[model samples]
Target: MSEIVAVDAEPLDLPLSEPFEIALGTRREASNVLVTVETADGTRGHGEGSPLPPVTGETRTAALETVRAATELLEGEPVEEYRRLTALVRDAFPGMVSATFALETAVLDTYCREREIPLSALFGGPPTTVETDLTVPILPPAEAGERAATAVERGYNRLKLKLGTDVSTDVERVAAVLDAVPNVGLKIDANQGWTPKETVRFADRLADENVRLELIEQPVPASDVTGLADVTRRVDVPIAADEAVFAPQDAVRIVHENAADIINVKPSKSGLLGAADIVSIARGADLELMIGCMLESAVGIHASAHLVAGSGAFRYVDLDGNRLLASDVVPTDDGPGHEIGGPGHGVTPDR
Candidate 1:
């Protein structure tokens, strides 16, 4: 095994297929950062960061700056020590977040390629395939219903609708989707757009409509844990904590307070190692796990898919971020997931 020589990062603008909106904001394009790790033996591996500033509280400039400083700390480190290297990145740049894992993913990719094993093997699991749920951003009810139908036409049975603007309008929007396509697995994410009362009211409305939702995600504000618990206990539908659980400590708190029934693990919120911690905490507390994405490119999506596929712990998956991109830095199948059979992440950047 050779020593790591250089770490490089650059911001890449990947255009979206269309405007993607949620309660937090809208994204016409993905603000992604790519990281490249080079070893002394001429091995190169790549990783990507897709930060939703509104959700993860990380900006493109901050991620790039973190990578620059990280390069100084990582150069000359042994590539075989990839796990320790990733934890070092987390310790040095705790605020960098998603970028921390981007570097770690690159290092792990290099290590896996050197060993000629897929990332699933690194996580101690055989290669497996995972299904993903498509998304419909905030839109009018009729339009939302049409989008749901189109997704079903494309062979996806699960759909997540981004809502939270108005309760009545939201109810109508979901009802419209049901009217258009009734038997699909329907999940709504409010992105912290509603109050606890509103969430309960909306759930009751959906119940009256005889809608059996797979789950409701982060309807109330992230800070409102008491309210989140209230809504979770009051509603018949299970509630998943997205923004509410950013770190393992947050997951522990949610467990102690009985705030949520499921925890959403968005890689962009915490890096690979941090994600593992959160997963362990969730499992210990008997909480279900959901793997989500933040509208990243194929590079980022590949890493998350490999992690989820390797672990086989998540009950629900929403890794359709790469599918939202018109193009990506990494080459991959024109779909939402990865076939975790090849070495490392089995990904290479076009650039």
Candidate 2:
């Protein structure tokens, strides 16, 4: 039996090629925590977690401390007892979702590597290439259009625009991008920055202006599910819930209330196990699934991509976090892109 011999985690800060602006804030760098688990048989498994203070209420310092504490609880355990080990880690760090994700991923990676199998193979799905949408950060209308055009030129057909600053200005930004790349599929993420009324107003204005939106995500605040339902009722565009749903219970409530047409699943926000549960709940409710990320490194993004490919549940993929990074832990054949091969999330950290 394979046994976990050691656990290690470290803080990783990678500079972004350009400032990533969104409704929440602007980030010039990606701050992530990398976790690794080593087995007695000399196999190593890697994982990554990024703590978004605004979204998960976890800062780097807190994440580091929580990860260290959780790893201490996992050392010397048999790799086969992953469920019990993960349950112990979750119980120890109840609110540290990112930390939990890092630990759980390491465990799973180690297990899969020991078996000489890909992570997707465990789910009985053949690994396949997944196309992802590049995000256009909130910018001046013209600048947004230029960026959109550039993304389309680079073989990305789908674009996600960050909105939610102001209704009129948001419309202008969308209009500018559409004017530049007329045929590109478009989706907008408000990041829970708009009120229900404001969300409806934006949708109406976009419709009036003849803008075709693939979807509008998290228009209203996360705490206001009723408000989300209100906006959903008013908008013809599909509404996806990101901040509003973090756990399976949240997924259940969103479906029960019919608050959203889709659920955005982030493994960092919910651990791999939790994400799987959320996927099951979403499929059961006949809700569309989207796999997203939180400004993570190639490690986290690649792991998330495997989840997206393995489940075959997600209709949308927003794994562009690595595109913002100046350097990547997992080097690609091409510079940086959404590609995972080999086994166990594919690549090893250069360090």
Best by lDDT: 2
Per-prediction TM-score to the true structure, in the order listed:
0.96, 0.97
Which portions of model 1 miss their true places by more than 4 Å?
Answer: 334-337
TM-score of 2: 0.97
Output the TM-score of candidate 1: 0.96
What is each predicted model's overall lDDT from 0 to 1?
A: 0.85, 0.86
Clashing pairs in 1: none
236-255 in candidate 2: lDDT tens per residue?
A: 99999999887888999999
RMSD of 2: 1.3
Q: What's the true lDDT of residue 63 in model 2?
A: 85
- Each candidate's root-mean-square deviation in Å? 1.4, 1.3
Report the C-alpha lDDT of model 1 over 96-215, residue by residue, as the tens digit.
776886898888888888888887776557667767889999999999999889888877888999999999999999989988889998899999999999999999998987789999
Error of 2 at 1 (Å): 3.2
